[model samples]
Target: MTAGSNSISPIPVAPVGLSSRAQRFVEVDGIRVPRQDFRRHRDGWIERGIPVAEIDRAADFQDRWGGLALPPAPFYEGGPRILNAGCPKGSGAEGWSFPAGAGRVSMPYGFMIGPDGAFGIDAHRWTPLHAGTDGWVESLALAAHATRWARTVTRIRGRAVTSLDLGGYEPVPEVQGVTDTWWRGEDSLIALYRGEAVGLDAPQCLEAHVYEGLDEWGLHGG
Candidate 1:
């Protein structure tokens, strides 16, 4: 690998036991080029059995691929990441703030309207219910963001929601030890949520059903 005046350029060499098409493409000179090009220029690093990390770094650059820079492909299989749906747990609503980690929220056993006008603890996930059909959600502007991350449940005894697990489709470079970093959404909403959670005031278009037999606090009945 040789460093250009601006960006890191990999010397082109022939791919080892691999065809050119199979190799992943990375941005070179503002254009997405194949891995074999690097191999052809770099003296067959693959045949030399160089460290994989070096090869990977050469293939992927930070400016073109990392930071807030737009990704070449959709980060996740589904859509953008939804940070705020505009629904607030009701007034006098039990609120709990968790550290940047994984855990589930158990609320009083009752239905509540989420900020996004959908039912259930996760308005994003239940969008289909409010949309009246899966097709509607499929066409939503931010449907990709809602569908990619796993659903967060209101019931305490059910599965938990971890930010790490509900990550973008393709892995992103970790920022400050954070797995999910990029903020992709409507420009205005993204601006509103700059490094902080944003809330929206929309109609309670759907019912957030609570699990039965649970205590007032969204916990399983003892």
Candidate 2:
């Protein structure tokens, strides 16, 4: 295999075989490109033959197409990672397979293995829930923040919310508190959520915020 240029890699394949782990992992370029457009790039590493399950651990199929090398993801407290989503016992890096119950918190995609039912909260796509089916909430906003690399749960108006590892990507709910939960009702795309912030005062929102207490979008490939 040869390292091409910065971010460009020419991962080679054995004439016949591969290591068990290497067989299951592929590569894709980083986040600079829109996911849908990544496939447009010609001549990548999809030919290396990564395992289906390992590919599932990545954010999108394109990521599995390249053989890019990235440092381990930076971690922070409260960044989405572990949770109480009824994950099987002893699953993931520290039992991070799912949430521990209390509410549904949006996790950045790929925080866990595969798309299997984990809530996807990418901000790249325009969400309809926060925009408007007919009338926007004219005066609404979201509030949330997360750390990287560690287990943590922040409280938005008292609601204990969880965050996941973003893999060095920018924070979701990109505008911070202004549009966090602000887009869920108007045909909006709900990201990760731990509890219902709907129909409650900030103080009351907390009373109901917990891992299991909230339920919105879930991970897709469990």
Candidate 3:
């Protein structure tokens, strides 16, 4: 499942969710590699009130990939730390929220990997960015892949993002969600981020990143 590997075909359309697909591999050095496994780390957190199902879900993603370096993006910086363990009884997460990872920069909150199979930010309130952690990983992989081949990469911020036209583009199902999304067109890709804005209640944080000038292989794959 590494970059350029022919084992798995390029996803033709986005999926409804990525929980079942969490086992999928990401590209690393032109080879497919499974994300780091965190089962070993789970042993230390069993008494922390993390649900078994939620723990399994978070463990499947396993935080950082061993030796797999990713580009500088707003992703998890270090590793997981059960966020709701200290909640005073009823005020805790309604369902469950296992720590996925912390952001590289200081923010009011961190990324959460559960409750269900959803991946999102935890700013005292859970704001799901993707249907599952796999979607998040898929997004990271797409960014890395697209950046390597796109001729031009553009960034749009604040109110200016509302004017862009997306007539021919289709939603990328693999990385789809209400707060954050990905779209693909004839020769380009668009990634929209509203998670920070929604999670932090900051409207000015709305933004989009466009990677254009991609070819068939870059957009999909052979």
Candidate 4:
């Protein structure tokens, strides 16, 4: 589905759970179905060691959670994987939208699709050691990587954020044509580029701002 399309599956009626390893599973009626084991790939994760029972479980899970089934090859590089959810709240009914609903399994980094259709991540838990620097450079690298991957999977181009409405934003002078904006949290920062904005917890990021809606960008990494 495109960025604003309602082609998203409705929230599942069954109980959804995330494993300690960040695996998303389903518990319906009374049966508990676990997700396949994930192995680390080049800066990403791929499912492996899936048992036959898990296949049956996946089928059942799909049946319960709108007819949306998991991808034949469940590979998550970054960003929130859209499995069975609706368009994000507030976005119009026209284009493809990343509606926040059930069946979204975010990476350990807390990448999620905000209600406004902007791609976001909860980097509040990250530390400077994650990138071996003070984290400003690391945050930019992560934002770029996540944006590229999010575009690849969802076909939804992220809206570039050119400026910020509050403080704590530092421009990346090296990367021309893209102005980055960040909202400082207690420990970390939530970032975006021109034409982008955070959805929930606006106060945590910015107290006052305008919502220009989500805009499309050219193919990232192009």
Question: What's each prediction's TM-score?
Answer: 0.15, 0.21, 0.68, 0.19
Off by over 4 Å in 4: 1-92, 98-118, 121-170, 173-198, 205-222
Which prediction has more favorable lDDT, 2 or 3? 3
Over 1-222, each residue of candidate 3 has an lDDT whose tens digit, in order, gives 332233432332222343323223232322222333345445655666555655555544443322233334533332222211111111254876655544556777776765666778788567898887657766766766777789999989887887879999999887756678889999999988888778878768888889999999778741
| Angstrom error at residue 165, model 1 | 16
Query: What lDDT tens digits, residue by residue, belong to model 2 across residues 132-214?
Result: 10011111111111121113333333433333322333322322222233222211123333222331222233221112122
lDDT, model 4, position 169: 39
- Candidate 4 lDDT, 43-67, residue by residue in tens: 2211433333333333332333323
Q: Which candidate would rank higher by TM-score, 3 or 4? A: 3
Residue 138 Cα positional deviation in candidate 2, in Å, after optimal superposition: 19
Which regions in candidate 1 have their CA more than 4 angstroms from the true location?
A: 1-36, 42-178, 181-222
Q: 37-152, model 1: which lDDT tens digit per residue?
A: 24343446545544444444433322122211112212112122211111122222332111111112332221222223222222222111121111111122122232233233
Give the whole-model CA lDDT for all candidates, comma-separated.
Answer: 0.22, 0.25, 0.60, 0.28
Candidate 1 matches the true fold with a TM-score of: 0.15
Model 2: how far residue 212 lies from native, Å: 28
